[model samples]
Target: MNHSATAMAFRASARRTLTLEQQAIGELIAKLDSSFDSACQELLACRGRIIVTGMGKSGHIARKMAATLASTGSPAFYVHPGEASHGDLGMITGDDVVVALSNSGETQEITGLMPLFKRLGARLISLTGRPGSTLARYSDVHVDVGVSREACPHDLAPTSSTTAALAMGDALALALLESRGFSAEDFALSHPGGTLGKRLLLRVRDLMHGDERLPCVPAGSPLREALLEMTRQGMGFTCVVDERGALVGVYTDGDLRRTLDQRGDFSLLRVDDVMTRGGKTVAPDTLAAEAVRLMEDSRISALAVVEDGKPIGALHMHDLLRSGVI
Candidate 1:
């Protein structure tokens, strides 16, 4: 056959595989019943973490399912079924929920542990393509992730079945997450090193320049003095404070440019005269992400950190960038 025929055949095969997998997922969604609800309730009521176990390709899917459950609100971890018989069974307990995945539902390594799970009094939830098989027969609740056809042409590989199982796992996790009212803040607590965690967990106080590094001048100080302070601190702006050390205005490089464009002899101008009065300020407790939004919305690069209306610190866009808060 020509290259064109070969490429066309490959594309056709890919399309068929995707169609089969999509159908499998649709069927799984339709088949979701009280059994799925029982599984979710078991997981929610579990005082200990959910223990997910499987073998072969199902094991890989189980590990991912465990990770998804853990990253969301449900505490879960994966244990290889092959390892369960050799002391790993100690990980299971009465308070935990055990979810065993096996498309065939008769995998010896998995079915062999049913009695042990029962003896431990841990609730058993099975995900399988074979609802009538040994694992499902003994399980407290069985989620049928059955697929009518495999994406593989030979109907041998675990293609469509695995996809259905994974989708089912995701559905359960998100449902549980919403039911628990899990917020982005909760997610950030679990992912403190990721970008989303930085946005949700980092506060202005963590990145702001405190009193020691603050660039500011009394409202009565001359523009020249404020400029000098800005230069000294190298923060591109100077906060103007009142007699009580409360922020009254701000003088930034933009203010200087506007003053210069007016062609005035601003050297003698008071900091208050040249400054933008009643400038936007943020509390020290503000989220760094919130600060970034404020800066972007106001078209400014810096903000005066205030507490009880008193100037306490200062922060700039670069500070956020330096700390990876952006």
Candidate 2:
């Protein structure tokens, strides 16, 4: 075929595949019934971990399903059905729920384990394209993930079927997540190395410069003294405190700009004359993410970490950036 015809052919094929997968997912919305609810209830009621199993392409989908369930507050893991016959069947127990994925509902490797699953008293939940197949009949809850056709021209490859099954798995994971009142903080606990965890788990105390690193000036100190402290700490600001070591105000870069604009004599002015009284502050225990919001809202770059009306630490926007809380 000509180059133009070849490009047209590729585009047509891509469109067909996307259209079929979209339809497959859309059909699942209509097909959702009490069975989906029962599956969620069974999973929620399970006292032991959720065991997901399948073979070949179905096994790949099962692994992802298990990971999603595990990350979303449900305890789950994937076990290969073929390996189960060899010895991995010991991984399952009577209290657990077994989620099996088989597009045909007749894979020998999975069907062969049905009697054992029953004998072990583990509840079976099956996702299969064939509702009347053996696996579905044996399952305690059968979710029909059947698609009318595959995206494949030969109607053989697992295209639309796998997409539908994946969508169903996501639906189950999120439904159970909501029913269990799983919060973002709970999700963050499982993902401590990711950006979301840094935002949710990090506090001002974790990122603030405290103790000897804190920059401070007495209320009546020279403006030059505060500027020196700001330069020495390299935090762009200095806390102004009373003789009792209580925070009275804050002197920042903005304050410096205004002092310069006024063309005041550096030798005669006290830090209190130009400092902002009771500037934006956060408790040491406050979430760093919340501090980010306050800084963005106030259009400031630094905050004094205060406790018991005393400046305990100082935080800068760069600190948050380094910690990945931004």
Candidate 3:
């Protein structure tokens, strides 16, 4: 009844069930047979999408399988067996493949729909325990998802059977992936809203100071004039450009402090004499992530955005970090 005893009891119960489930899953993997390969071939050869259906626990597994297949380059979706029996069967097409899930291979709600699938000319792939059962008998490819035991202590629930079904679904998805030669870059496009896509798609041109905010002064400008430009632009630095507007050099607050540190001889320093030449700049098309890495490595706050070797704008880490993209 106390906290310690309750925790101990919970852990013991969890460990026992987990061990049984793992053993059952291990047996299923070792027994994967030719039917598995045939099922993969049937799905790969289909011109249309995969239609996955099941009831209850199998339905939950079917939904995950559908998502996995869809994201991994296979066109697939989950259709509830009960829903399909009513009016949802119209979603299936003759070029498609149907993957039906039922632990006993005799779930009436699931098996009942096989006749309609056949009538529509859709190939059937069954993930079930009993190969001789109605659903398996009708399937063009029957994957023996049978398990030796249930994780349920009473051997009544569908725990181990569902695990086998999910693993088989993953196998089918990955098999289709290898056959189609899917790649990570292709995957990133499908997940364009995530961080991976941002790293692959975002560019320097998309985020940089341009035109009026460049903090540029003419070559003959005095250090005092360049300092005023840096103050007005707040880019932590100023650029000195030739008449053609190509980058000549850069000067930051750091340069200003170091110059003033040596007895304030800044009066003799022209923008051309004091500026740091060949400062780091990036093409407008460079990825924002790559720019961040460059800035971090160089220990600098900003970089010039250039086009055809001419500085057009500036960008700082603050801008990238604030976008929640860094």
Candidate 4:
């Protein structure tokens, strides 16, 4: 084929696939009826974790749905239908909710276990393209994740159908999350190792250098002494405090450089003579993300942790970076 023809063919094929999948998902919006509500209700009322099962390509979508549900406060896990047939059926219990996915709703490995699920008295929820299929007929609630056609040119691959199923699963999970009033804090607890967890769960106190490690000096302390403290602490800044140990000013390396350029004599200078007064400070309980924002806004690299206007701790950019709080 000619180069122009090949480029045209690629664009045409990609556009066609995307258009088909978009319409498939659009069709799902109309299917959001009482059945979807019933499924969500059943899942919410479930006393135990949701058990999602499917076969083949549908199984892959089911696994992703299970992970999304688990992370979004729905509490779910996936079990392969083939495994369930081979002694994994014992995992399903009376208190659990079973969500079975199949594009045709006739996956033998899954349909074969219907009787055992019925015997166990577990609630059955089915996600299928065919509402009249056997799996739907046996389900307590059937969420129709039907799609008109596959994105595949031959209309054979599980492309649009899987996307619809995944979207439906996400819809259900987010609905449950909202109904339960699941806050960001609750979400962070489940994902303590994720970036959102680092932002929401990590606090200034957790990364701050406490009193012993803080580089602080009295207001009357000599500039040389403050610089030595800054060097000892290696934080690039030293906090200046009053008689009550309250934060009054701050002297950073930048301020020292500026002072040197503006003045020739520094040997007799005191902390108050060069310190910048009323510097930005943060409370220990402030979010590390908020601290980062403050530092970025002020164009500084460190902040003093204050309580009741008293300097109790201090921290630098490296501390936040080392703790994965940035």
Candidate 5:
């Protein structure tokens, strides 16, 4: 009961829990069998959405499993077994696959719905500790997510078992993701509001300033005129184009700084005299994230968006920053 004894006891308990959970996850690697494969094949063949259901602690894991499966391209959603017994059973159809999670494999709320799932002709994939239980017996594929013992000192809580189930769910989701050739772009489509989605889906056209907002100066225009355009547009840069409206070069704030460093007669100079020819440029359809990389590599803050040899728009590093591309 002393402070030292109490601290040692707490550390011992924490280590024991972590060790049990680690072993539980490690054991799952050897437990994977043909049943896991069959479960994946069934889920892949399902023409309708995947419906995941469970009860109590298993229900929490089922919701997360559904989310992972859905975000990874499996198209799944969680359904509470207790709710399924109500009007929610309408969510399940003949073409769907039902993934049920039950530590004991005999959760009454779920097993009670097995006949209805069968009647609806939906395939059942069960993750259970006891393969001989009713829920497993009724399943088309039963993946055993058993653990030797709970992390709890009394072995009364669903600790290590839930960890094993979670690991199994992740393994299933990633396997199917690879099997279907799901690309990062596909994942981005489902997560369009996240950083990855913005990086993958946002294009230069979506963020570029075009038309009147695109600052441009004609070749041979006075350097003073180009400076005015850059100030007016506030893009810190201006594109230099020929008489044909084709991009000839770019002039940036950096150029203005260098021009000032020269301390020459600015009134006599033309925009072409100080412009950076063949500057960094990107297509309108190019990803904004890729544009960021180009800017970083070229050590520039702005880029000319060119199409068919003509500058159509401009993009600044500030624009990318505001859009969360940085």
Candidate 6:
């Protein structure tokens, strides 16, 4: 066959798999009932973390599910079922709850450790295909993650089952999150390494150009002197300060443009005369993202960073854009 024919065949296969998976996901959504509530109850009752465990392909899904739970207000971690027999069982504590994943519901490693989970006072929630299996029989809560067939052509691989399990796990997490009134700040605390973390955790003080980098001139300073100060700092603006260095007004490129548009005499004006007095300013403790929000709201590109009425620094929208916060 030609390259285009092969590509078309591959696309056809992919489309079929995606359609099947979407249908399977809808089936899983319809299956949410009392069992899901009971499982959430057992988890919420736990005084400790949620311990997720599975074997092989299911283990990979379990690990990711655990991470999602941890980041979304539920503390969770993955423990390999095979490794549990090899002294890792110590990781599961009495106060914790175990979420075990197995498509067949009869995996040797998981079945062997089912009693241990209960014996340690840790309640077991089983996600499996066979509801009548021993693991499900002993489980305090059974969530049927049964999939008719996998996306794989062979129909034996764990594709559809893993996808269903992941979707179900997300459903459970988000439901619990809503019930518990979890907030974005809580989510950001868990995702400190990602872009969301930088936006939520970083403050105006954290990124502001301060001290030596501040562009400013005295309130009585000449317009030409303020222009020189703006040039020296390269902020395209200069703040006008009182005798005690308190922020009184600001002069910017836009202000200069407007001043020019008015056909005003620059030589006759002072920084205080041409500057915008009592301009909007932000506190040093404000969040950088909040600063960006304020700037966007006020339709301004640059702002004076002030603390206790004194201009301490300056910030530009370009700084936020470069930092991936905008």
Give the lDDT of residue 141 in candidate 2. Answer: 99
Weakest 10 consecutive residues of candidate 2 by summed lDDT: 261-270
lDDT value, candidate 3, whole model: 0.86
Error of 6 at 197 (Å): 0.8
> Which candidate gets the maximum lDDT versus the true structure?
2
User: Which digits, one per residue and each the tens of the lDDT, describe model 3 over residues 26-45?
Assistant: 87778788988898899888
- TM-score rank, highest first? 4, 2, 1, 5, 6, 3
In model 3, which runs have C-alpha deviations exceeding 4 angstroms?
253-268, 272-274
lDDT of 2 by residue, 80-130 (tens): 999999999999999999999999999999999999999999999999999
Over 4 Å off, model 6:
242-246, 258-265, 296-300, 307-310, 321-326
TM-score, cand. 1 vs. native: 0.95
Query: Candidate 5, residues 136-171: lDDT per residue as tens digits?
Result: 998999999999999998999999999999999999
For model 1, residues 1-326, the per-residue Cα lDDT tens digits are 99999999999999999999999999987898999899888889999989999899999999999999999989999999889999999988899999999999999999999999999999999999988999999999999999998999999999999999899999999999999999999999999998899999999999999877999888799888999999999888988888888888899999999999984787778887779997889999999999999999999999999999888899989999987887
Count residue pairs with overlapping backbones in model 1.
Answer: 0
The global C-alpha lDDT for each of the candidates, from Candidate 1 onward, is 0.92, 0.96, 0.86, 0.92, 0.95, 0.88
TM-scores for all predictions:
0.95, 0.96, 0.86, 0.97, 0.94, 0.91
Lowest lDDT 10-residue stretch of candidate 3: 260-269
Listed per candidate, the RMSD to the true structure in angstroms reads 1.7, 1.5, 2.8, 1.2, 2.0, 2.3
Superposed Cα deviation of residue 214, candidate 5 (Å): 0.9
> In candidate 1, where is summed lDDT lowest over 10 consecutive residues?
263-272
Best by TM-score: 4
Per-residue lDDT of candidate 4, residues 1-326 (tens digit): 99999999999999999899899889999989999899989999999889999898999999999999999898899999898888888888999999999989999998999999999999999999999999999999999999988999789999999999989988999999999999999999998998889989999999999867998999999999999999999888999999998899999988999989998899999989989997889999999999999999999999988999888899789988887877
